[model samples]
Target: MSWGVATLGAPTFLTIGLLLARDARSDHPFFWPSLLGIVALSNAVAILRVNQSHRRAAFARRSVLALCYLRAGMAAGCAMFVVLGWSTGALQEMVATLAEMLDASAPAIAIVMGTWSLALALALAFGLASFAHAGALHAWIAFRRGAPGPRPGA
Candidate 1:
């Protein structure tokens, strides 16, 4: 789920940030290539992890299915945003802005640092979102398992 969330989020922030950095009236773009890459990577990792833990995953089919559904929804949402940005020309503006940044007079180190900083920020945000989503899922799972949750009395 962590990988899944990050996969869904990084491209999203990248496109949205690109649009904003463009100083254009519109602020949206789709990163379709990113969606393909993320979906593949996240699902592969999930399957691999489960297989590696086969002893514990003997009956984990439902959980994995739920994860797949979540990922598909994430991918669809990403596609929608990308299409929206494409229609509005926000994606093109973002490309232009990125090209200009690369062509700026700044030193190579400075540019690398700036780009790295942006990546880190996106990663941090994605990680937080992943954790939050996982927490919610965990709660739901526990509830389904009949684990006693906090209530009015001990």
Candidate 2:
């Protein structure tokens, strides 16, 4: 795999690993791990398929494909999170608490903070997904393309 990919994926992988570790210590450990595994494996397979098919494709084409993958992953992740959170009642609880806190503040301030929180969450999700997709693309490309030649005079 490409070093670039490894570097870019480090944080995401680390975060996943930490979450997996934490889940392992919990009473219901298998659930989150299974879900995380499915998401990670599916994304990897999709990236590999795309990379294999577009090995010799133009940069612009590959980039567009990557963007598609990123958006798809983000949407899937968000949907899964929402569904799980809702089913567990965690989402409702969190929303109720947030509303309570917001209600105690000034109307304009609460509105601005709520909007800002949403924007920040969305931005963070997008950034993480972008990094993961880029890393996957670079990794698959490096794997399929084989080793590169040594630099001149090295």
Candidate 3:
């Protein structure tokens, strides 16, 4: 099974979601719904991957599945926080901080704000995934390195 295919879809959706959601004009027909859908789908895939494998393959599968869940969950949650802020008027605070720059030059401000938001979203995704998989890193390596063998006493 190609783990990369399962892994790539979630982040791609999330990155696009966050970028689209950040726009002030974000009711752009596709942003918010896409974010929600991608998040739900990513979690579904993670759950499926974790449960689908046999016990003997569980150790190898667990790391990837766990990381996928962690990444999707954290990134989606953070992006949701930003959306919640938009809905609840907390985004006013963010806008206030950017007001001067935005007034002076809208494009630069947009670039800066968008980059900051997306960078943090990506960081949260990567950091949570790394932490979740850290303990299993060596186990995965050893599992792959060990020679094939019959069941003990079989």
Candidate 4:
């Protein structure tokens, strides 16, 4: 996959999420959540692309697998928050209306902090993914160029 989509997309989505959630205000409520879903899907696709390739260096394969798992976890976490925010909008709105009678504001945890947390988590996941992919690419190049790689059992 392209670095822009795989590497740069992560930080872009994370930044969007952070900005949307920063002041607990959003110009469009679903904007950040939709982007989060896209980020999750994009990461997942990148991992799958790596997995489906047969050209990976033997030594690099193991490390890349670990990175895949890390990305999966982060993707799942981000998707969860997005799903929750989307599914619970009406419920939260109702609660907010009800809360108006009892309190002046809605709950503090209404997707704002969750989005920020998702963004941070995605940042780590994406960083690891980039590192893993670059490592694999470099190793592949080295192998193609006949550079010496580690010997078995050595």
Which candidate number would show the highest TM-score if scored against the true structure? 2
| Tens-digit per-residue lDDT, 58-98, candidate 2 | 33544566565555555555555556555665545555555
Candidate 4 weakest ten by summed lDDT: 138-147
Supply the TM-score for candidate 4.
0.32
After superposing candidate 4, which stretches have Cα over 4 Å from the reference? 1-9, 55-154
Query: Between the candidate structures 2 and 3, which one is better when assessed by TM-score?
Result: 2
Largest lDDT belongs to which candidate?
2
lDDT of 2: 0.52
RMSD of each: 11.4, 7.7, 11.1, 12.2
- lDDT per residue, candidate 1, 38-63, as tens digits? 44454345444433444343434546
Question: How well does each candidate superpose onto the true structure, as a TM-score?
Answer: 0.32, 0.49, 0.33, 0.32
Question: What's the CA error at residue 69 for candidate 1, in Å?
Answer: 3.4
lDDT of candidate 4 over 29-146, digit per residue (tens): 6645565565555555545554444245333454554455445545554455445545646335533444444433646774455445444554455445333443343233322322
Candidate 3 displacement at residue 23 in angstroms? 32
Error of 1 at 19 (Å): 15
| Candidate that beats the other on lDDT, 1 or 3, i.e. the better one | 3
Candidate 2: pairs in clash = none
Off by over 4 Å in 2: 1-13, 27-31, 41-60, 94-101, 105-154
Backbone clashes in model 3, listed as residue pairs? none
lDDT of each: 0.45, 0.52, 0.47, 0.48
* Candidate 2: residue 10 lDDT (0-100): 43
